[model samples]
Target: MDFSFGPEDERFRAQARAWLAAHLVGPYAGLKGRGGPGSEHEGAEDRRGWERELGADGWIGLGWDRAHGGYGNRGATLTQQVVWAEEYARAQAPGRVGHIGENLLAPTLLAYGSPAQRDRFLPPIARGEELWCQGYSEPEAGSDLAGIRTAATLDAGDSGYRITGQKIWTSLAHEADWCFVLARTEAGSRRHHGLSFLLVPMDQPGRIEVRPIRQLSGTSEFNEVFFDGAAARAEHVVGGAGGGWQVAMGLLALERGVSTLVQQIGFASELGEVVRVALRTGAADEPTVRDRLVRQWAELQSMRWNALRTLGAQSGTGGQGRPGGADPGAASVAKLLWGGWHQRLGELAMQVRGAPAAVGPYDWSADRPYELDALQRLFLFTRADTIYGGSDEIQRTIIAERVLGLPKGARPST
Candidate 1:
């Protein structure tokens, strides 16, 4: 594939850069590079306003069809999307607060939702008026999604369902207005069967609870959400009841969409910061540290190219329109590549920081006992990169079975 950007793409990039510069001012000026992976607790309300700012300017939902409140059909080409992502990261804009709604939920609704459902959900998301969270992983499930025990029973007197279970590691659940849940609808059903994709509101008292999970990085962006008979309308079910496995899998595919490019851009920024610190601290003068930095730069370039190739493959196969049709193994491969790369980057970050990496703000009288610097936080957070989304073992198994046509691994007896 030709990697050169044409005049149109360059123009788009300039426009994106200019918009970010102009809008990232006033109250938002201080937020530049403030809210990211381990620092999600910073400037959250302001970040939500920034999300609306993007929506008002038609920057959100660039990949969805115009009919669905997006820019246009095949909304923005792969190149244009990449340009925006790169520019956004370069501008050091605040991390998006509505990413779950914009990237994951909106696309899933476009793919598998009814017209009414689309009309209801897409507009709020497009306007950045609401936020969403994933309800896939449970305390007992995590990466083993097939083991999710969150169940929803049909209400006898109403056209809704009552959800009752616990969801752990629910990122931004406290801020989300809704949750797209994968819950068992059919009784006595096991594994992937009998599951339904239900859209549940989070505001109902006596039904839903969101208890923030404080992390080692001193953030509560992740939460433990409890549903004690939380309710969702029947029409809110995407891809029909008992069809959640397919819908959930489709959403997971969307998780590896153009957003992966955006993520890499952020990764590049973090890597750049590490290099700058190393140079200032004389860590770069050391042969080993310098060698690692060079390798990281090279690996980042390779990751960008791989992302472009994956995007091209999706566009060629009409996977842009049918998100569920994208290559499954490609998603696993991307996950494995970036997950390991990020974890290593974290290690390198600490090495560059040297002895100071061990020190953090420690005050017994303060509300928080400790405060970590950016590098220390990065180290602690990325430790879970390979574990949270999908473990290295799971990704390897996926590539082995799905991509290589290898024999399936033996399942443990329940």
Candidate 2:
């Protein structure tokens, strides 16, 4: 129903808009249109400044508890979070330095971590002081996360475990000071039940190495990580041993929710850019281009509203990780729709630009100089949207088994 924000919510939205207007100057005005603040070395101060700026304003962790350097959940409505995501998209602020930390790890810590763990990790993450990365997707384990081979052996003295393994596709590993990783704690035990989650420091002397991966767009953002004889203190473990499957599932729920909402909002700005470019180049008048743009706008609006409904329902009823709960399956639907739409929009953009879209990568400043690099990169990257964060096939399976009560599929013997 009523999609409109009530009086108090509207007031909060107005306040946020005003604050963002004053503090955020050029380039940061549109969330999706703007990119990350330079590379690791170049962005250090800007990243810190943005983090501290948001942290000081109490906007860094929208759902975090107040006692831990956050504004605290404070009965914060999901609508508020959605508004923040959408508005921040409009604001074009630099993306989070520790996305894995803030979105996945922080939530898990709050839900299942010890009080000490919470105190140790949450504040710096909120303040942007300590960046974190994820060590989940290994060379052997990407979509089949249950198939991870990284192991942690318990110490003989009843102390911490020794970790040695390699992780690939680790986004931001080189810049991260910390990582939330999954390791097989039990030998000869297979499946998801034998795993454990560890909070690891990246700056340690031995047992770890970080090598950045260059993307097709020439960005060294993701990395390959190796850990040898690394020690993880017992207290760093979240949940119990053998309970990592459950924790991983919960973390996936967090990932799906955050990605579906924040990312869709972010993608909307790109669509807007497409429209602006078309209008600037006189291509907006073409019948087919006009129809596609209109279709995209409609699809985006529909998807965003559906996401809002899911958020409101989850917030009011509290069924994020419960069986027969609202279920995180809503995220799958969002991802499928948004991912497909993004891919299509990129195609349409290229078509509209025609030969001009093939030009060499020029700086975005020159008039009529189409930044084909950005368009090409998006077109290329959006091809993987349905594959990463659980593939489209996986999402359909989730809907079939969990949401539709389909019979479980049998697995092959290894």
Candidate 3:
């Protein structure tokens, strides 16, 4: 359990910091601290450009190995990857539009995808030429993901699959170049069985439609994507055709990798802001506010250590399966820890402002709609923290059955 970073890691950190300082300038200079969590709608075009800047500098896939028919990723160690995440967060770099590809999709491909799939997809993601979105959650399947009803039929004519289904709460689907979708490929198959993970192109004019879902936060980062006979090349299938359940599960585990560390760092920044606000507004004089702030800081520190302890274990296997950590349920544990912690921080952000928190700074121009301030948006968005990303209930069930060896919960008839 060594938590310390050596001089080499520090050198990598310095390199990352210097690169960010050099590039986050002029047009991009105003983008610092703009896009994150609830604020994904802000500076999106600028952030996409920033993604290209990151890719050009070899910062996109630090952990991807060039040895496995991969492209020129930095091949950096897990510690160095964490160093990069930390530096990126501390610099308040734009919330990465490419994170789904660079962190989740890339790793999943290395572990399960064919070499051809890797060659086709990895390079664009590394170059930031393409962006991706996950098509896992459907209207009926969200937390009970095995219940997905989306179906993909193989088309013998064009030698591809014709997929027809709807995906809801799809983050950034409106702007994505492609979508990795989980759909039923076997007619009689039920639940997680007979499912295929299909790579769907988003540009099909008549077949695919992206409708933005407005949130209480007044942002439409989430979307509902309809695939009415959307086309997917048969070659684009990863982990082969009936193997999507495994691939999708593995990607879920990877969701808790270095990005968790990055997210925790962002949580720290949010907490700091709340503390400063409390002090400025004299809310710190209240014993309850002071206690809550101190507790949040302590919990955040604990989360950092847990993430570091699990980083090596997860990295060994590309964060797939029950990644080898002190606790086999570390991924679930991490999700539970942060999801609730972040939601609380958002509540605190609003609480510190008292009456002013209810109101917000808005641009009520004749052309644009009203907007919520950062803290107001934070409160609104975190309301869904426990519900999205597999949900708190789902995380707990994973721990109960997988980690604690409890009897499986009942499932409705498929």
Give all TM-scores, in the order shown. Answer: 0.95, 0.88, 0.96
Kindly provide the TM-score of model 2 when superposed on the true structure, using C-alpha atoms.
Answer: 0.88
Residue pairs with colliding backbones in model 2 are 30-92, 31-89, 31-92, 65-72, 66-72
Listing every candidate in turn, what is its Cα RMSD in Å to the true structure after a full C-alpha superposition?
A: 2.0, 3.9, 1.9
lDDT of 2 by residue, 107-199 (tens): 777767778888898777777678888888877677778888999999998589889999987877877888888999989888786899988
TM-score of 1: 0.95
Regions more than 4 Å wrong, model 3: 317-328, 362-370
Kindly give the stretch of ten consecutive residues in candidate 3 with the minimal lDDT sum. 317-326
Query: Candidate 1 lDDT, tens digit per residue, 1-414?
Result: 875888989989998899999999999999999889999889989988988898888888877767554433236767888888889988999999899998898878877888889889887887788999999899888887888899999998758999999999999898889999999999988888899999999999889999999887778879999999999999999999999999998888878888899899999989989999999999999999999999988988888888888778777644436664656698888898899899999999999888888887788676666778888889999989999987888889988998899999876432
User: Is 1 or 3 the stronger prediction by TM-score?
Assistant: 3
> If ranked by TM-score, best first, what sequence of candidates would result?
3, 1, 2
Writing each residue's lDDT as its tens digit, candidate 3 over 338-381 gives 98999999999988999998865566666566578888888899
lDDT of each: 0.87, 0.72, 0.88
